[model samples]
Target: MKKLLILLLLPLSLFASLNIAVTYPYIGALTKEIGGEHVDVEVLAKGNWDPHFVVPRPSLITKVRNADALIMNGAQLEIGWLPPLIRRAGNNKVTPNASSFLNLAQHIELINKPNSVDRSGGDIHPDGNPHFHLNPANVITLAEVIKDFLTKLDASNSEIYNTNLLSFKEKWEKKLLEWQTKMESKKGLKVIQFHDNLAYFNKAYGLNNLATIEPLPGIPPSSKHTIELIKLIKEQKPCCILHDVYHSTKTAEFIQEKTGIKIILMPHDISALDSIEDLTSLFDYLTGAMQ
Candidate 1:
């Protein structure tokens, strides 16, 4: 009896579940959906934290130190410090380059790939757009990639991952169809936004993308551009001028006053809004607001 008890305890200690770490809460939710009880999922960035300037706390290093895999959006979005964090964690099992690194952009159709990048002014991604997570369609595309990655990493639990994939796919597809129906009923739906962050949602919901408050991506709003943008918005008469949670509301307020278009606040990143702290809530609240 003593030998059997000791043997059982040894297995539990030696065969603990895999430690999986995701870069953001949204990704953590997805991992949990698939991983269920088989894997331990930890999110490095909270749902409300800025994904770019997140300082990896000492505890984060410890978490990553024990993880089996590390996942991130990774289209240079994390170029600032993730590489160093992975190194400091000193975990051979969770090294950014060697371990199971799931860079999500690999599966989606990338855009805004500049022929040449010279960031003389500010941050830029020459590799292509890294904001693939903004669109619901891209969500499906990336889901397939994630499922494959999980299966490859833990082949022993491939069936569980597949089961989660099937369930998630059905629910997401149903919601997509419902959202499309709601958007299709509206005619000539016009919108002006601070940034092109809504490109994916606009496409998914059939919302008209008239123009942006910001003249270009990465460029701040200038008085001259704002004047022109207000004029354009006045001419088009859009229903709202969408401003992301992180964007300066000064431009949005100016446009709203000059053009009388409604100011709509949105969360481009999952962490940016209260109701949209996770993927499902993000879509639900956004679609409801749009409708």
Candidate 2:
């Protein structure tokens, strides 16, 4: 009877799932879409907040402690927030060099890398721009990487992960075509932004970003810089100012009043607003915002 019980339990052990942790809502969504029933995702940051300034609260430490694996956007995007949580989690599986820890930045090519690194540059990523996910094409690449990571951590569910990926790819590609069609006419249009957070998005759609409101990355706006921006906007005649949801629009508004330009609120992640609840909605709102 004892021997029979052990044999019966063996199959259940083989099919056990993993508990995964992700740094951002977008990563959490992709992991769920790829891992399907084989994984549970714990997202650490709120979607509406600034990605650069995620508060590493105590609760996040507990989430990391209990996770079987961790995936992050990397490229130093998490440098300001995630390290402390990982150190406090005391989970070896989520360590930087562990097989269970996956960094998505390594799998894709990063743009906007600086020739030199310094604090004077204002919160620059030494590796390149960390916001690569803003590009719809990069989202497909990230999904594939997540699928492989899940399979490696739980080989028994490899087939399930693969199947889920195929379905996701089919749906995502169709969405990409829709977005591409919508953005086709907006090419070469000039715009201003609070920060260069949408660097990848601008590149993908052939939109020319004339300048940013911030004097430098992570630096607050200065009166001198704002005055210069007013002059530039008057001379260049950009269509509008693409402002992010997190930062106060006071500066952008001032520019708008001076130049008679429009200010469009762009959400950077899922739930950045009530309407943007998923990856599709995030891009949909973005592509449609310019219009």
Candidate 3:
């Protein structure tokens, strides 16, 4: 009878995993990779939507409220939506200052910080670009940060997280080298984009972006700006228009109609397209899209 009782209790102990909530799909993927079997991750934002424009739905409040910890991309990427959810959830552990809260952006250096903070700049991030995860190197660094975070949060599972971290690093290092080689031939290639969403990606491969279809970040396309872009495309003869998934392709299609330039779809996150399932696959698709 005692042996039977112990066996029943064993299943309950095994289910004592930590519940982690993340603001983006990439963070959720990284947390799961490091947390292994010791955590249950709840992602608040859909991978298909704009990372900066996630809706803080009531359902997300439940996710945040129940989470034992929270991890976010931060750098004000969540400024538009996460705050309301956090406020409503009333989960102190997930608050900005809590030890249980991890902001991945603080650990990495961001690029393209605006010279001035104003609506005129079209929704610029004052702390710089928050899309650091698009860079493979930054992803590796974030992975280590997440591993350390999980280790500290659940010390009993530190070994598992550490082991997973080492394995992930090995695999990622190899893939990085492969991507570097793949992108080598495309260096110094000029491109255009609807937004500067691919800034990190462009920097990674030396893809020069002459201009964007949008007059400024987060602003809709204007006919006057489109005319200017059409003129620029004629003069610059850029390789292609790198358009993000969530945004409409109408402007880019119009540009292509005018200039005969190609428009390539660039996905910013996993599930931004049906084919992009995970971190490596996301980068793989981006690198492959260069052609």
Candidate 4:
């Protein structure tokens, strides 16, 4: 009877999956891709919402409380909302100091580090721009980081994680080549944006970001800024306004009426739009949007 009981419990231990809580849809997607059958991912935020502003809800607390590990975009992207969730959940495993906690920003070299900290700058990220994942090359780096993180946490399935990482890297490298070829002709294309969220993407594809609709980050468009932008647009003659889906297009539309510039809605993460179902589709839409 004792031998039969031991045999029954052995498979359960081998097949158990780690429940990982990720702060955003993209992280959740990446974790699932690498974790495969060995991990269960719980995404805390919706992709369509602004990554800077998430409403910490009771349900998110429960998810964090139950997670075996937690992953975040870091670099202060979640500064507004995530800290509250972590405090409320009281999950040591998900705390920043814990071994189970993973801050993706720590692994990647962040860009746009501010020279000084001030609320007058309109919600600047002290560490840097947290949207490093927008660059496809950084995506590969993130995959490697996640692979090592998983291996460290669950050595029992290290081989499986390694295999998954290799497969992802091979496929992504091919996609990178394809994206580069598609964007080759669009190099040095001048464009406007509602916000500077696409800094990494523009840098990756060599798109020149002329200016933003807003006067500053996290600030709304003003009539003074709008008139100035109109003048700049007529002078600079940018291709279009690459607007984010969450913000209202009223300002961009007004600019279009005055300047006859185009407006293109850009999705920042997986499921950010209905068409963006996964990582591949997200980039596919983004790279194809110029046409």
lDDT of 1 at 216: 62
Per-residue lDDT tens digits for candidate 3, residues 133-252, read: 888988889999999898888888899999999999999999999999999999999899988888888898888989998887888999999999999999989999999999999999
**lDDT of each structure?**
0.76, 0.92, 0.91, 0.92
lDDT rank order: 4, 2, 3, 1
Candidate 4 segments exceeding 4 Å error: 1-8
Q: Candidate 2 — which residues are off by over 4 angstroms?
A: 1-15
How many angstroms is residue 23 displaced in model 4 relative to the true structure, after the best TM-score fit?
0.7
Q: Tell me the lDDT of candidate 4.
A: 0.92
Each candidate's root-mean-square deviation in Å? 3.0, 1.6, 2.5, 1.6
| Per-residue lDDT of candidate 4, residues 42-141 (tens digit) | 9999999998899999999999999999999998889999999999999999999999999999998887776776777675566777888989989999
Model 1: runs farther than 4 Å from truth? 1-10, 13-15, 186-188, 269-271
Q: Which wins on TM-score, candidate 1 or candidate 4?
A: 4
lDDT-better candidate, 2 vs 3: 2
Candidate no. 1 TM-score? 0.86
Better of 1 and 4 by lDDT: 4
lDDT of 2 by residue, 79-192 (tens): 988999999999999999999999999998999887777866675567888999999999999999999998888887889899999999999999999999999999999999
Worst 10 residues of 3 by lDDT: 117-126
